[model samples]
Target chain A: QQPVQSPQAVILREGEDAVINCSSSKALYSVHWYRQKHGEAPVFLMILLKGGEQKGHEKISASFNEKKQQSSLYLTASQLSYSGTYFCGTELIFGNEKLTFGTGTRLTIIP
Target chain B: DAGVTQSPTHLIKTRGQQVTLRCSPKSGHDTVSWYQQALGQGPQFIFQYYEEEERQRGNFPDRFSGHQFPNYSSELNVNALLLGDSALYLCASSRQQISGNTIYFGEGSWLTVV
Candidate 1:
C-alpha cells in the first residue's frame, strides 16, 4: 500500500523550518526519503531502517518510529534551493523489493 | 562513478502497442528496479531484478515484464499498453543485499500513449 504524507504543501521563508511526515499502515522495514525538482528525477536523501533511529544530512534530518509506522523529515533553516517535492518510500517487512511511495509534500522556500 | 542511466528520454506510442525501455545500473550495482510515476503523483514500484532474475514485483500486471542482463543492465517491456500506462518510467539501481542502501534513480523515460 502507498504511504501517507501530511501537509500536502508548505511554504517557508529563508532561515525558517518545516517538517514533512510519512505514515504507513503496514510495518516498514525501512523508510527512504527523496527530493525531486520540477521536471527532474527524484534524488535520494537518506534511508532510515527499522530500528527507530535517525539520520541527518546537513540541516535536514529524519527520524523513523518503527512502533508508530511513521517517519518525519525535518528541514531546518530552509533555503530557496529546498523548494521541491519530498517523497517517502516505505519498504515493507515481507522482503518485497518494491518501495511504496507517499503522495509527496510540496515545499516552497522564499527568500 | 556513473549513476543509473535510462534511454529514450521521451517516447510516444499508440494504445495497444509495445514499448521497451532500457536502464544501466550504477557502477558496481547489481539490482535494478522499475517504477512508474504519473503526473502529480509519487512513483509506484513495477518490479525489481537482480542476478539476471526477477527477485520481486509489485502489483503490476503480466503485460509489464523485465529482464536483467549479466552486466546488470535491465530493460522494462510493456506489452499491450494503455493510455493509463503513459507516464514517466523511472529506473533505480542499488547493490544487492545492501539493505537500506540509497537507490539511485535515472532521469526517467517519459512515455506518452496516444
Candidate 2:
C-alpha cells in the first residue's frame, strides 16, 4: 500500500525549516526519502533503516520508527534550491527490492 | 559515473498503439527498475529487472512489460496504450539489487497518449 504524507503542500521562507512526515499501515524494513523538482527525476536524499537511526544528507535529515511504521524528514535553513516535491518510499521486507511510495509533499521556498 | 540514462525524452502516441522506452543503467550497476509518475503524484514502481530477468513487479497490468539485456540496458514496452498511460516513465538503477542501495534515476521519458 502507498504510504501517507502529511501537509500536502508547504511554503517556507528561504531560511526557515520544514518537516515532512510519512506513515505506513504495515511494518516497514526501511524508509527512503527523495526530492523531485519540476520536470526532473526524483533525487535520492537518504534512507533510514528500522533500527531508528536518523540519516542526514546535507541540510536534510530523516528518522524512522519501526514501531510506529513512520518516518519524518527535516530540512533546516531551507535554501531556494530545496523547492521540490518530497516522496517517501517504504520497503516492507528486507531485500524486497520493491518500494511503495507515498503521495508526496510539495515544498516551496521563497526568498 | 553516467548515472542512469533514458531515451526518447518525450513522445506522443495514439490510443491502442504501442510504445517502447529505453534505459541504460549506471556504469557498474546491474539492476534496473521502472516507474510511472503522473502529474502531481509520486512515482509508482512498475517493475525491476536483474540478471536479465524480471525479479519483481508492481501493481501494473500485464500491458506493461520490460526486458533487460546482458549489459544492464532495459526497455519498457506498453501495449494497447491508453490516455491514462500518458505520464513520465522513469528508469532507476542500483547496485546488486540491495534493498537499501542508493538508486539513481534518469530524467525520464514523457509519454503523451492522445
Clashes of each: 0, 0
TM-score of chain B of 1: 0.96
Tell me the tens digit of each residue's lDDT in model 2 across B1-114.
Answer: 688999999999999999999999989988899999999988899999999999999899999999999899999999999999999999999874453766778999999999
lDDT of 1 by residue, A72-111 (tens): 9999999899999999998775345568899999999988
Candidate 2 lDDT for residue B35: 95
Model 2 regions lying over 4 Å from their true place: B97-99
Task: State the DockQ of every prediction.
Answer: 0.74, 0.71
The positional error of residue A52 in candidate 1, measured at the CA in angstroms, is 1.9
Q: Candidate 2: what lDDT?
A: 0.92
